[model samples]
Target: MATFSSKTFNSALYLSFRPGYNADFYKMLYDYHMRNNGQFDTAVDVGTGTGQVACVLAEKFKHVHGVDASAIMLASAVQKPNIKYHVSNGEDLNMIPSSSVDVLTVAQALHWFDHPRLFSEVKRVLKPHGTFAAVGYSFVMLENHPRASKRVYCLGNEPDQLGTFWDNGRLIVQNLYRSIEVPLKNVERHYFPDESGSELPLMMENVTMNHFRNHIKTWSSYKNYSEKHPDRPDIVDKTVDAILEEENLKEEDEVTLIWPTVLILAENNA
Candidate 1:
């Protein structure tokens, strides 16, 4: 598991800056699960960072439980009547009853988990024919501006310090979780659907350069970089300024950011 134990990592920023799954994505998951399992009573979202995905699950399921290893992140999660947040490791979810979960979801978080152990726990908690969905997001994109998009890409891929700061599990996400061993039955893989019912790129609108910077600040690699390279303190700021200057964008200018996600769905044989 990727530990967010470093003091430099801010859970609040993460919660505020990170994008949430849209209504279309949530509806698609529930529809798919019901089509196969014929029920949508309970769901468990593992590695539910700040309960973003859990909140979406709560809309369809009678009961929703979100589990995360970081207490600080859980502390800031929004509370919902049908959703209950808990501090638990993905590998061992003792808090959730065995064979009680109807569906299991890992939204943009599976890469950080111990895949084999997490899968074992999923099999244990899921009822017969239960569904497991592991979702991964690809690189962020900027619309109508290739330069700005490339800058975002460079920010993510460049900076040699990030290569070391990022956990090994990130490599799995970069590979679209294709190499992760998922021991389950009836596995299926696809891209998430947009609101238009087509598999389009996940997009967010009215974003600004400052908004992008804030989101970037929430990255684990950037946090680690700030801690280790105190001398090069202005690295993040300089990068953001350069992107804004290059794009000739004001701080409040609106831009579109798109994130493409991959979904891996499997069924519990038990």
Candidate 2:
């Protein structure tokens, strides 16, 4: 989390490589909220890196706020008439008025939060029966290429690689936020590509190898490893090269990348 706050962090690269939630995903979220009598007057997106989620919420909510502890990240947020950006952590949302938010979201960020404090804040700011959604995606798998997928997985799991560089919060994300307990009521968990064979439209198809490499470069673990081993050949480049060799492909060749995604939703019934 602190890696993203660093001034040296590449916010542009992060925004460019990170996939945004599609309309169907947002429709499902809004439908759940509406079915539970949730309002749409105001929404807040905590830990809103680059304001991607907030920008989408702005289209439906009358007022939307994108909050993050990183000023450098907020600087790159998309500007919209109905959206505002704030520099604050999820645990302390004192700037937002109590019981004023209709829906609160934390995308790819809930794992880094102090859960108790953040949940307390969520209850304080969300209206009665308001929605609280937490969304994140786990490891990316190369479709139809098991060897390349394993290489990508090992890059972040093998101790000699970027494994040790990741923050402890990453484990929670990898587990699909199963350990997280939202104090709100009517809690539900949904997964893309569930075990029962259900699938969501989250996969990236025909993506250039270079684009995929750039995505790996945006990882915090990769950044940490590069800083510590400045003299070593770039691990990202090496990993991409190894992947290409394993699959007999060129950088311009297109491949499919699938990310196992999770969305947990609850209502602030309290």
Candidate 3:
């Protein structure tokens, strides 16, 4: 299936609802780059929806480039003075000079790309030893609410539920330790769950019915469903109501939501 990550329907919904990356996550990226002796001389964020991550890149580089297929998204990103924005799909990197980018990253928008095409272009644009990374994040509904298990399918089928984007980073360390050599050095720092199981601490959020309703607008499923079923009454509201009624979630209630992110980094494999 095609993806909704471009600036139009996907981006409109994303900017309206998607949460920004956490400082912890941001620090990890910086630390990785620094550890690897990588510098952000020139950076690009592909599929720069609403420019959220691009804004962060601006702080590191002399100037950052944000590119997307959607002009609307580029326009939004253009508002950043140090961040140049372009409306070019990743499949065609002709606009970007070869070996010009030091760090190339994609956030929450990787699955939408034609990966073979994108990977090839990334190799072309990145200088030797340059790092390419992709990171994604997702809501932890089950972590957010114990009762959310009943709605696992809803969460799984989300248009943007790419890469099971929910890991605590520490868990990644654990898995790597199990599989590969520890303290695995050598050109290091160059690399690198849809389930809500029992008794996990809630990634809680302050939520009332209205607050939850507002969040509905942030959901692509809710947005698409609304467009298809405008006369069908508000299914999102009904879903929220059902959850609230069943869980007895009151105005003062906060529910835990799970959010996991997967970060992948590799030297250009050309």
Candidate 4:
């Protein structure tokens, strides 16, 4: 399998671990696209993980380009019609012609990008006045189940750093957007409705453990961590099994599970 670097993990990870985006999620995305563009036109889904966001872009935009550095990620996306899914690193976006896209978007994968390089490349690919949108969502343990929250935090990943460090608002700000590391001097973020419809949609919307696992598995950090610390699989499995024993497991039949997300949209000045 051809591996795409620049990302923490390769493409098979994209396919296996990434979560899905829900209908309300896509509707808001498309609505924002409409609001941003005055109409839904063409879009490029960057870091196209498992074609989850790609499928959403395809629904609204007539021309949807799904670009990734990984052949493994792109291969799975080719079957989708009216969409051009290609392999191109996020930093080196020369494969896409200048000013070709009406909107450029990413989902859970934005934090992994090299900030300066990604913002620059995004400027190059987007047409003058084109939109760049990104969003991410994760669980707030205390809201869903206090017991499971306490159990997972006490026994979950990095217990020592869990409570104060890994709290809800901070996680989304730091991990999802990389807000502090890379300030947006050239761009200003336009607010979009998250699944929760909260003023700051980045907050948790009653997410459960399975909801957390569904997407957490997609991240390269987790992949790298698990690879380095093989003990995690056992730990995660035991916790999940315990959850199953204690309460009914959240069930879904879709091959790719989706999440409600936080989206950021920015447009270059005309």
Q: In model 3, what are the clashing residue pairs, if there are any?
A: 140-258, 143-256, 144-256, 144-257, 165-260, 166-260, 167-260, 167-261, 203-257
- Point out where model 2 deviates above 4 Å: 201-205
How many clashing residue pairs, candidate 4? 4
lDDT of 1 at 12: 84
Backbone clashes for every candidate come to 0, 0, 9, 4
lDDT accuracy of residue 65 in candidate 2: 91
lDDT-better candidate, 2 vs 3: 2
Better of 1 and 3 by TM-score: 1
lDDT: the better of candidates 1 and 3? 1
Model 1 ranges off by over 4 Å: 1-3, 159-161, 192-198
Better of 1 and 2 by lDDT: 2
Q: What TM value does model 3 have?
A: 0.73
Candidates 3 and 4 compared: the better one by TM-score is 3
Model 3, 48-127: lDDT tens digits are 86788888888888878888877755544536678878878877778789988888888766655666788778888887
Top lDDT prediction, candidate number: 2
Candidates arranged by lDDT, highest first: 2, 1, 3, 4
Candidate maximizing TM-score: 2
TM for every model, in the order presented, reads: 0.92, 0.97, 0.73, 0.69
Q: What is the lDDT of residue 240 in candidate 3?
A: 67
RMSD in Å for all candidates: 2.6, 1.2, 7.0, 5.9
